[model samples]
Target chain A: MSAELKKALYNISALADLGQAITSESVFHEKIQSVFYVITGTFLANRGAILSYDKSADRLITVTQKGFPPADLDRVDPEKLMSLGKNEPFLIGDSPVLAIAGVKILAPLWVRDEFIGVLLLSGKLTGSPYTQEDLELLNVIAHQIAIALNNHSLFMDLSDKLEENRRLYEEMRHIYHGTLQAFAAAIDAKDAYTQNHSYRVAKYSTAIARELGWNEHDIEGMYVAGYLHDVGKLAISNDLLNKVTPFTPEERAEIRKHSTTSHNITSKIKFPWQNVQDMVWHHHERLDGCGYPEALAQESLSDGVRILSLADSFDAMTSQRPYRKKMDVQTAITELKKCLESQFDNKIMLVFCKVLEKEIKGELPEPDILPYLDRDSDLSVISSMLEAIIQELSAP
Target chain B: MKTVQFSVTSRLVGDAAVIYPKGYLNNLSGESLVKECGIYIGKGITKIVVNFSETDLINSIGISLLLQIIEDLKNIKGTICCTNMSKFLQDTFEMLGLIQYMVVFPVESDALQYLKVGKV
Candidate 1:
């Protein structure tokens, strides 16, 4: 074979190898850097830089550079140099890009029909201008670089869309909580005395969690549990929830189902982090396992369930209801202590007591539990027993 | 958030159906409203007025439900408007672009009249 034919065949083989390498690469900077490496190595050029055109800003964006100062990249007019004929490699010192002293040639890069950018090449160590064969090889490689850049751009667009969708999904999950809150508000609308009761329960539970030094994530989880604890009441009627008269056996059974309903409702939310669904479901459970719905015992319950139980009891006791008036602070505290062994967790009640103490000492308008004592016919006995205990604890 | 007397009442004044939703308009209440409106629509009633005089609070979930009702009414080329909106809900309606599509009157009669004869 003729020497020219042999060199032509070798260039075609090298171009094919470099094309595979460029297309397989994903990172923009690294891919373009590889392009420059192949170009300079084949042509024996000491320095080279690739600049992709920014159609929006009408500027040449420097993608990669080797052995060249970046400062002069600003002075290189990529638009002016992009369409040069194959034989015309701009010489050194003619343009500001090659004017960087030792720099030599600038080859305009094209792909298909469009002008993509310019490839600036400096002098080889052998001290010779680019030969005809060298220029032909470099142009073919430039075509490969364009395909690589196009592939990289497409990959980036797809990646950005995926990220945007992920962000939207995260935002939608938060909005679901707001939707449930709205549902809670609608439920609250059924009665004036019970208004904001769930919100207050959540607030109280969060406070107790904070007092216990729980992490922010767990505190938020507790808040969700408290908020949804009474949500199952949505299935019952306003008449049933606010019935002044005592409920019949069937009505009472339906009313007692609210806790399980709340749990099921919260469970459907599917939160990304730790969920309070089970906690809300089990909020009505007692330590002695005499509570309603599933009647889960202490062993199956979590700290969140126990915390919600205390918070819900405190708010219900202190708040005014259709059948009962509000309870005084002292009386409510007594009731909470009395229920400790049967209804609530001691550890949770201890933290809640601190919250109550802060409000009492600060003279805050905490829920008035005094009227609740008047409504509960048997509360006076527990009240006196709690009062005696409080006096003993205060003696210290 | 609770309005004890919370209820959604419906009545017919000639060709226009008027719905008075009392209390907080959140998701649960919204579900009821959607069912009520769906009934009125199924009965071939189109022109409607939603009186919010008794409603004191509304949330995004409620707004989304309202959106559904509005979209359904619009599909039939039927007119629906609201009346007696609180100051906060008025702002909410404005921000959510609900005001541009539906006329909001400060009086129930005005909403009724607009729905009945297409006048503000």
Candidate 2:
């Protein structure tokens, strides 16, 4: 094989190596700077700098440099470099080097479509005119370097997109949870008897959902829904809702409609819980088809809805209601256990019981207690979370 | 200048309210609709009739806020009856799964008639 052929093969290998390393390396800047080092070291050049055009400042900035004073080379403005024709090798005389170093060969690092920057390999120790071979090698190296840089840009963009998606998802989740929490708070505020009921239910439901091996989304929905399940009771006449005496049959009919009313309220929302409206609407439903409104019974409701039904019942049973004192946790669980197939799904009930046990043990902060019906409800949870928000909005 | 006129009217039946809103529900004019509905809540009105007979364009945020208001009303045991929605709005609402929580009516009178509890 000819010497030229061997050298060509070696440069190709170098380019491949550079591409692979740039693609995989997580330490971004170091990998980029290393590309210049690879070029300078591989080509046996005396010095080199990778000059990238700054679109913003409308100048060139030395992204990575070697064999030049790192600080001074860093300060050199790219805009000062005059426009060299596509194929024109940047001459030492026409170059900005006239003001700086007594240069020898300056080559434009042309990538596929455009000139990326110039590779300044100053005054060869050999004092030779750069051969066609040297320029070709530089061109190949430049191509690989550009590819690496573009890849880096894309990686940064993808990372940014992923980050943005994550942030928006979290914000939406927060908004959803906040809305439920607000609704819960409003419910508690109105009655004053069920101060901590919604909070307890949210915690218990979240734990139950997690125990059932539900994903974060389902767990979050259950937590939020549990908190706001009783929000419909708010529409119940405060007079009728808070009345200690037994309700008249007409009032009983009004009370029976709260679930559907609550469902109706949530139905307007466009979240993942398209079914939650149904679940909330049907939470009071019995397995015997004796439940109000739709009278949906066993196997008619989804497991999630059933789980919510069990959770709502458990919370209501254990809460200190105006009409009834809070039942003990054990009694609440037993009551739920007895209601299996009649109201709560047996399998879900078992899991819910375990979840309730976990809540009593204090494993996590009560998950999103207040149901925020809107942005306003969400803001009110953090004890002056809204204050900071109002302050920011009110700021000049 | 193109004009998009949207109007919402509220009628109270027992404890519920019926809101008759006409015109577009997109981000541009959703604020006015929200403000109008908010007035009902402020007046201790829970039940609502949202008549979307002539409404158009419900963006994601607008839909979100509308849902929020519904949820708010739920906490208070109030119902919002959406009536006279266009076929386009109805399809979008169904696809978005809003039918689960909200009841829809073909006409304003049907919703008022169904939602009303007094005298048949």
Highest TM-score model number = 2
**How many residue pairs clash in model 2?**
30
Q: Over the stretch A239-354, how does candidate 2's per-residue lDDT look in tens digits?
A: 88778988899999998887777878877877575456666777777887877678885778876677777767766775667777877554655576566667767567656544
Runs off by more than 4 Å, candidate 1:
A1-49, A53-59, A63-118, A122-127, A131-163, A209-220, A245-250, A264-275, A353-396, B1-120
lDDT of 1 at B89: 78
What does the lDDT read for residue B92 in candidate 1? 60
Give the alpha carbon lDDT tens digit for every residue of A1-396 in model 1: 554664455456456546644765345665565455556545545556787766667777788775677887867665566546632455656654435555677666555666667777777644656777776666666666766665665677799999999999879858966976887787678767788888878888888888789998788778777777788888888888888878899999998888888878777777654758778788888999999778887798888888888888888887888888888656777788888869888777766665544443444465332222235445445445444554554454
TM-score (C-alpha, index-matched) for candidate 1: 0.49
Candidate 2 lDDT tens digits, B37-109: 7888888886677877667555443454475566567667877778878766776556544666677888777
Model 1 chain A scores worst on lDDT over the 10 consecutive residues at A367-376
DockQ for each model: 0.00, 0.00
lDDT of each: 0.70, 0.63
